[model samples]
Target: MKACIITIGNEILKGRTVNTNAAHIGKFLTSRGYEVERGITVKDNLDEIKWAIDESFGKYDIIVTSGGLGPTFDDMTVEGVSRALGLELVEDRETLEILSKRYKELSAELTPERLKLAYIPAGSHAIRNPVGAAPGIWISGGKSSILVLPGVPREMEAILDQADSLINKNDRFYYEATERLAGVMESAMAPIVNRIMEEHAGEVYVKTHPLKSETRNPEIDVEVSAYADSAEMAEQAVRDTIREILAEARRMGKK
Candidate 1:
């Protein structure tokens, strides 16, 4: 399956935030054997968020969004999704009850701002947030499914973990293996990686990263990965690719 991630927040676009949520979500989806095709970052504007969602809809099998799910005025992810899908924003009583109970425990009142967190796009279900008050939104219909999560890193991760079943509905598997070389340069490893990719073709992918500057003390790490319908197939493909890379590195007289 293919996936697209949308990060919504002025903080991310303005460089005020590092946008680690996108990276986390990408890695998470990739590990589940989903091909992450694109990642988009938009400001807190509703139109921008809606545009991002509209563009990604039907183009990808899964759409995961992070941020703008707070109680503040800038938190408009839910509304944007609602407008994009032409769905009404309806208040979920269970979500409201959860928010109310959470705030009461903190000796805080469920003000209007806090109350807004309970509203989600019609026909969507709320995924409970284990770390925050705003529940994540899950919308499934048509050709794609959307998972809208909070901007906060911990809350987003927690809710994503809780919604794993929704994302990884199949038994597909992903496996990756890496080998570090002491004196190999990225440029030198590139050819070997290319050959391994050609040999494996669609079964595996190989990439090399330079751990140290090639002009100085050169070191490289080769990563081989595969996604397959079975865990054994994925593992075997990655292992075979790794072995080929190591053998080629040894032939180059580099440790």
Candidate 2:
């Protein structure tokens, strides 16, 4: 299954906060064997969110959205989701009561605006919240399912962990991964990685994320992930690829 993640917030774009939700969710989904195709982060605008959702319908089997589920005016994730699906937002009394109880348990007051968290798009299934006020929404249609999770890191993590099995049970894939090599630049290593990928022909992904240091030279993460039928085959392919990459690195200055 193919999955895409959408992180919503202008803060992310403005660099006020790093958007870690995409990476977190992508890694989780990929570990379960799902093919995480793209992870996109967008501002809190309705048009952009709706456009992203609409465009992703035919391309992915699952779409996960995080952020913009707060009480403030700028928090319009639910509204954008409604617009994207051509649905209307209606208050869910049960959800509201649940939110109220949550606030009460925290020794806080639930204001009218806070109650708006219960107003979800019509025909959407509620994903129970154990750590936050805004409950996630689960909707399936057009050969895809979308999950709207709270933007709060802790809350999203809780939901993803507690509800992992039930979220998308049947959608899993196998990925073989191996990483090696230290001081190599991605641009310089791109041609070799590309050639190796072309030679393999199966679903493979090669990426390099460099780590910088002031006291020492930078080290690159030469990671290769591939998909196959069995764990053994995947492991062997990755091992062989790593050996080849290591040989090439040894020939160069990177050790």
Candidate 3:
């Protein structure tokens, strides 16, 4: 399965806010066996968000978007998604009730701005946000699923935790193992990684990351990962690849 992450915020484009949501969503999906194929940053413009959604729907199995889900005027993620999917924006009564009760508890009036959070695309499920008021949106189409989350890192993570069943719809298993090598240059590890990848072919993938300057005390971290139909299979594939990598490093006279 493949996933695409769309971060909608002008703040992100202006470099005012780091897009930690995309990183978190990417890692979350990858651990569940979905390949994160793309990460897109779009301004709060409706057209850009719609375009990102349209482009990702058919190409990716899962589309996770963050930002613009608040009650403020700039929060238009729901509307953009509605337009892109051609779904009518309808008010979810349960969500409205929840919001109303929440505001009443705070001794605050439910203004139009606060009421706006209750509207979502027709036929979409609202995933409760554990840390915020705006509920996350979940839409399941033929082969794709869209998960709209709040931009706030804490709220996004909390909503995702509640959305485990929706996100883990597939049975594929993914496993990764990493080994740190001291005094081994990434330059030398590159060929070894390539060879291991070729030898394992579709079963495993190997990559090397240099931790220190190659000219000085060269240290590299080699990561081997695999995806399979079962957990045992994926784990065994990564284990085998890691063993091969260590053997190759020893042959090259690197500890």
Candidate 4:
């Protein structure tokens, strides 16, 4: 399965807050064998969020969006999702009731701001957030699915952990992993890695990201992934493949 993560918040873009939401979730999805196509952070502008959601459908099968689910006026993910799916924004009764209960639990009165958490797009399933007031929205498009999550890192993580069943039910994808290889040169390793990949083309990905340095020293980081039915199998494949590359490099050094 291919997925994209969109982290919504002007604060993230302005560097007021660290945008760890996308990066964290991307790693989560990647570790589950899903291919993460792109991870981006956009401002709270509904149009931009809508556009990103709409565009992600064309490029990825699943889109996981974070941020913009709160009682604040700036929380616009629900409306943005509505526009993306061509639906009307309406208060979901069940979600509203949940929010009301949360307020009561806190011995606080429900205000208009708190009620804002109840707005959900029509025809979308509400992802209940037991730990937070804002309920997330889940929608299915033609061939894509979108999940809107909270901006708070802890809340989003809580929902993700408790909602593993929902994620697993979405699609069937195999194993993939990425490791940082910061001490190698891509030019010196490309031919050998390519040869290994040619032997296992259908199930493995050998990606190298070269870190650009103004310093005289440079480093290339390599990430290896193997696709299989189980994590153990995939992990083993990656280890064995990496071992072969390392062994070959060692032998070459001796020659």
Compared with the true structure, all predictions reach lDDT values of 0.90, 0.79, 0.91, 0.78
What does candidate 1 score on TM? 0.94
Q: In model 3, which runs have C-alpha deviations exceeding 4 angstroms?
A: none
Tens-digit lDDT track of model 3 for 95-209? 9999999999999999999999999899998988777899999998766789999999999999998888888966998999899999899997888788778878999988888
Candidate 4 to truth, TM: 0.84
Query: Residue-wise lDDT of candidate 1 within 133-229, one digit each (tens)?
Result: 8899999977789999998999999999998988995677889888889888898888778877887798998888888998689988878889899
The alpha-carbon root-mean-square deviation between model 3 and the true structure, to one decimal in Å, is 1.2
Off by over 4 Å in 2: 103-110, 167-172, 182-192, 208-220, 247-255
> Which residue runs does candidate 4 get wrong by more than 4 Å?
105-108, 170-184, 209-221
Q: Model 4 Cα RMSD, Å? A: 3.2
Candidate 4 total steric clashes: 0
| TM-score for predicted model 3 compared with the true structure | 0.96
lDDT of 2 by residue, 10-85 (tens): 8898999888888899888877677888888888888888888888877887889999888988888899988988
Better of 3 and 4 by TM-score: 3
Error of 2 at 209 (Å): 4.9
Model 1's alpha-carbon lDDT is 0.90
TM-score of each: 0.94, 0.82, 0.96, 0.84
For residue 199, model 1's alpha carbon misses the true position, in angstroms, by: 2.0
Model 1 scores worst on lDDT over the 10 consecutive residues at 240-249
**In model 3, which residue pairs have backbone atoms overlapping below 3 Å?**
none
User: Which is better, 1 or 4, measured by TM-score?
Assistant: 1
Better of 2 and 3 by lDDT: 3
